[model samples]
Target: MTKPTSETPAEDGAALLDDVERFHRRFNVFPHEAAYVAVALWDAHAHLLDCFDSTPRIAFLSPEPGSGKSRALEVVETLVPRPMLAVNARAAALFRSVSDPAGRPTILYDEIDTVFGPKAGDNEELRGFLNAGHRRSGVTYRCIGDGGNQTVQEFPSYSAVAVAGLGSLPDTILTRSVIIRMRRRARNEKVEPFRARVHEQQGNALRERLATWAKSVQDRVAGAWPEMPDGVTDRPADVWEPLLAVADAIGGDWPQRAREACVTLVKAAQVNDKGSLGIRLLTDLRDHVMVGIDRLPTVAILDRLNALDDAPWADLNGRPLDARRLSRMLGEYVTADGQPIASRNIKTAGSVLKGFYTEDLWDAWARYCPPPSASPLLPLPDGADTD
Candidate 1:
């Protein structure tokens, strides 16, 4: 996926993205998922150009084996600049390769689950590097040469990275990535077999075009700031900035597709994290939160929550739900600065106590939680939850 840097018209960046998408379609992937992978391919060359504060890592994950996760990476390897397939790359080699100013390798790290699995902490330095390298100017300082010539040299660690494996990566890494959850292909979904010779030829041709297009548009891409979709903020905003900019530079359906992909994928990642339990709680509390009432006292909230017949809260640890446990379970939605999200104090029951404001809960539900009406929280009929 590596090629020499060159120049092209700004409009060609879109064409390059289109080519990347064509290469991506040789495999069976969801429409938005393929769109994301195409963005990552363009990003692989964008490093030499002006980039946002963070370089979004493309994470390919699956629940089980043989889900085309690696195959997706293989397709990416052909089109990205200076591609390196390091399924088992040592940490030292990775650092040195990325530091190269002549050409930075687009790291396609396979089997990342094992790299960050139970023994991941054992390779703490490498893990730390991956996390730090997501941002521009991220560097690893190494002292080289003998005692007399020994001097600290800063190694540029920032580069485009694509990781593929089973299940999720560690939180630090996952949060910095454009995550694509792969699935075993359904019997009806068919794709061309990824024969090395044929695919490589196709991929290499696209790679050259990408290099040329990137050269032409690097200056504009560097200064370009594409407007992000609503609800995308903070780190998620930083991570997707490059992709959206590429889509904008490319223009047409890509811009719409990129925005849709950004919102859909980012929300999916947020909902999939530690907030799963909070999401469940939010789903059950929809009626109370969505009603005209702005706030409710903790006791009243617990009464409604515990009243649900099929809810686990009523018999948590063989005891009914209480203030302390309710607070503890829902506390996972706090902001990075430790501010509570979706739940806060309000003047209710004639006393200012901990409770959820309608606006706050609604924001959390819209951003980090899933559809509340997808399934009945209480499987029994509406009146059957009187227990």
Candidate 2:
């Protein structure tokens, strides 16, 4: 039977939502290397609106106070619809108003960290707002009681948000963000024009067109969400669920591509266990120890690992790395024939233990440690002349 066409409005909206790449190709222009980042942010923003509809994102770009972070946002403001630019001073009140039942705002806070970076108290203040807004939840607090005493009250609000900063933010913030690291601009490269359109009436018309189309396909955009891959099963159901919902509404290749994009983006911004102590690092350590496919005394292995005297980890403060540290670090990685080892410069039982390991770190850590050699032993000299 023919598959049913995505009949939902949200799904149709996903299908109708603007494909960012089209604009690039149409202009015969390729964004800088960070263009993929731009796409991810754009997709997140679209999903933000489609999901919460009124929840605005807080997108930030930071670089050493002057790597043109603000300038980048200038370009973004020019392109995005209904952009609300706010100085850090105005950010909290802007969010409070957005969270207010009367008029919720979608906001952009530029250089917000400066306000908090000065002291721990300031940091605490920003953290509260960030924690509260990172994912929309009902806000509750004490209100005045009927007897002129304080009373607790709480209310719900839907407000989508975004924030950007230099390097990285606190782990709490990172856990809930799509990070973009802004690099310093090159000497001779060019940046496109950035400005609010005044004379161009057509820009407004296009924005209206895009917004209109977005509103029309809301339901179908939601349907494709159920099919997203399993890796992200752990995230809160509130955030990406809606974003994926919008992606599914678009159906066909988009649902898959968008899913990939969503996962890739979030994963890129996150720090994983593999990244800090990955296979490469592990392999390098194993190589230093000279592990093979056999058994050896565990003490020998520790000795060899301790042999490192000048590796990066073992380097003394304010002193240069010495050769012993590097050697020691490498020694810790050595293993035996299917068993771990410390060193191999000695014999086991009646025979000399031969070479420590026949394979290198690259192969060993990929878990492809080589087999012991099977070459025939050399024969004794037949009849040497009397000395």
Predicted structure with the largest TM-score when compared to the true one: 1
Off-target runs (Cα >4 Å) in candidate 2 are: 1-68, 75-82, 90-92, 116-122, 140-157, 187-189, 198-206, 222-224, 236-239, 251-253, 271-387
Poorest stretch of ten by lDDT in candidate 2: 371-380
Model 1: number of backbone collisions? 7
Per-candidate TM vs. native?
A: 0.69, 0.54
Q: What lDDT score is found at residue 62 in candidate 2?
A: 51
Model 2 scores a TM of 0.54
Considering only N, C-alpha and C atoms within 3 Å, which residue pairs clash in candidate 1? 1-80, 2-82, 6-215, 7-215, 7-216, 8-216, 14-250
Residue 24 error, candidate 2, Å: 7.9
Q: Which candidate is the best by lDDT?
A: 1
| Model 2 per-residue lDDT tens digits across residues 40-113 | 33543443363542232333545465565565455444345555566664434554565565545444556656
